[model samples]
Target: MVTKESWSMSIWPMAPWKITFLIYQREKLLWIGIQMKVAAGAAKGLEYLHETADPPVIYRDFKASNILLDAEFNPKLSDFGLAKLVQLGIKTHVSTRVMGTYGYCAPEYALTGQLTSKSDVYSFGVVFLEIITGRRVIDNSRPTEEQNLVTWASPLLKDRKKFDLLADPLLEGNYPQKGLHQALAVAAMCLQEEAATRPLMSDVVTALEYLATNKDAGQGGILEEPEEGEEDHIEADS
Candidate 1:
């Protein structure tokens, strides 16, 4: 599935899943053009899964690891073991067992075995949170209860003053403050505890595209102090 760009991508070292991450070190290209292109590509991949996949594949187990990357760092979503298909008239898909990475599971589906399109929405929200924060979905270093990524991050998303605290320390504060705020709102919508409130994947993709396009005409920054050695959160689309 190469788009003919120097051609250097392969799914080597397969594990429990069929995905692999592109081994990018610190920063690759700081150009606004490349970054926005990668972001849109990621959004489009998710859009295909939600709107184009037959029966609309619900990547029930979406996580950072499940997102593979290409030479250009474009995201390619992987792993279909837990993928679900919603029938034409069926409200939801039920499975005998709930299966998903602990930190990536949608709350409602985690409690009840019923899976829906919104379940994947919640996972995307988690991925969005990681993209914004540059943090792992589940880090054990945090205090009990706080160790849960979504629960800990959800509150900060609602408050601007507090939201900055969640940004990756490496970024230091080198991005568009207002744009970051807008992205936070989008993340809040996707991470809604109630599935009914989350935006459709198509809507999420649209919002991201608009943000990138609007910001492209001006400056390109994600925080106040961008660290040259900051880790890239390109896995957000996984």
Candidate 2:
């Protein structure tokens, strides 16, 4: 859990992630550059929690809804209710009851009740994929094959020719194709089912920082409305 001191600090300067969704709803656009910025900033935040913190931390809840942005759109991670401290050199994971938002949870953690920094990495990958695709982590309204964003995107992630298909259709070809490939590559690394295979958050931060600096990463994406179908998939903590 987040310490009392950490809890006492203010987090009021920025817009919440949900507000970002509202903005997209009104303007029909969320820039690819902006997405990269958010991803990089959030990655740095997680890097600190995982590598630079005194004891290291597992940001057990690292989903889009938990991120906030300042007026300049710099991202801040919030809600540490699910955060866990790690004793580096002592153990590899924190054994505990499984918890976290379903669609964003790492498969290993969700199945084994073992939490690690890499679990946060997986969650970050899901959010990154959401940024690139403009799709929710899970949306039941989509066709069955497409409901789980990760599973649906897995095959396309491997084929260079189908990379474009993984991009948000709402981007409408505005983003730099090369940058999209790099961003997706980072996401693919983090989404590796084997926790040990995921890159450390510091490495993820480095890659994302470089991606964010590319001037041609391009402009905007519209948030498409989900088509009519069964109830939307839940993202409730479990």
Candidate 3:
């Protein structure tokens, strides 16, 4: 038998997707700094679930629609229907029926029905990419070549020279190049085809916090090149 609990959370005026849709209607992207803050808050929440909870929880469904935004755009995670508590002990992963929104589920979990904290990390990465590119995870309206955000952007993400192409056109070339590089690096790590290679939510939080702080400080520079290993992997995969 399963039990459920209900608790109150202050109302959030919108979900990230709703906000994105609104901005899209205006042909604009959310300010990069605000995007960073939202990403940080969402990462912190996932970090708490995966690390601070008594029995670490795996948020099996993590996506933009599940992230609520207050009037000020602070992000709060919602919908725990697919959440699962990891059993205490040495088990590193929970074997379960594969369930989650497509285009967001980690490749490993989607293929093998294995669940872990990294599964959530992969979903977070997809949302992060959406925030950066101002595109949906899967948009069939786009040209067939660009319909799947990850499949289309994965190659672009590897080359610093092509990083500019990955930014949302709505940003109007206003975002900091250095910050874009850093953010893409973090996203690439989280979206690794090998789930084991994804960073922990805690590390993701720290990286995003730094980006948010630096963005507020008005930092700007040429984007850094990806590491040799990353470049090689991307090329090989492509």
Candidate achieving the largest TM-score: 2
What lDDT is obtained when candidate 2 is compared to the true structure? 0.75
- Give candidate 3's whole-model lDDT: 0.76
TM-score of candidate 1 versus the correct structure, residues matched by position: 0.76
Task: List RMSD in Å for every model shown.
Answer: 8.0, 9.2, 7.1
Model 3, 1-238: lDDT tens digits are 2334754344545554444553345443344446777788989999999999877889999987888777677877888899988889743564667888989999888888888899999999999898878888899999999999899999987787887798767666655556677788899999998888899899999888887776322232112234434433322111
| Model 1 lDDT, residue 194, Cα | 88
Candidate 2, residues 160-192, lDDT tens digits: the string is 778879877666654566667778889999999
lDDT of 1: 0.65
CA lDDT, every model vs. true structure: 0.65, 0.75, 0.76
**TM-scores for all predictions:** 0.76, 0.83, 0.81
lDDT of 1 by residue, 1-238 (tens): 3346654344444332212221122132332233334445566776787788666777789876777655555666766777777777786887889999998888888898778888888887787676666667887877877777788887787777776677655555555555566677778898888899999888988877776665422133243333354324222211
Better of 1 and 2 by lDDT: 2
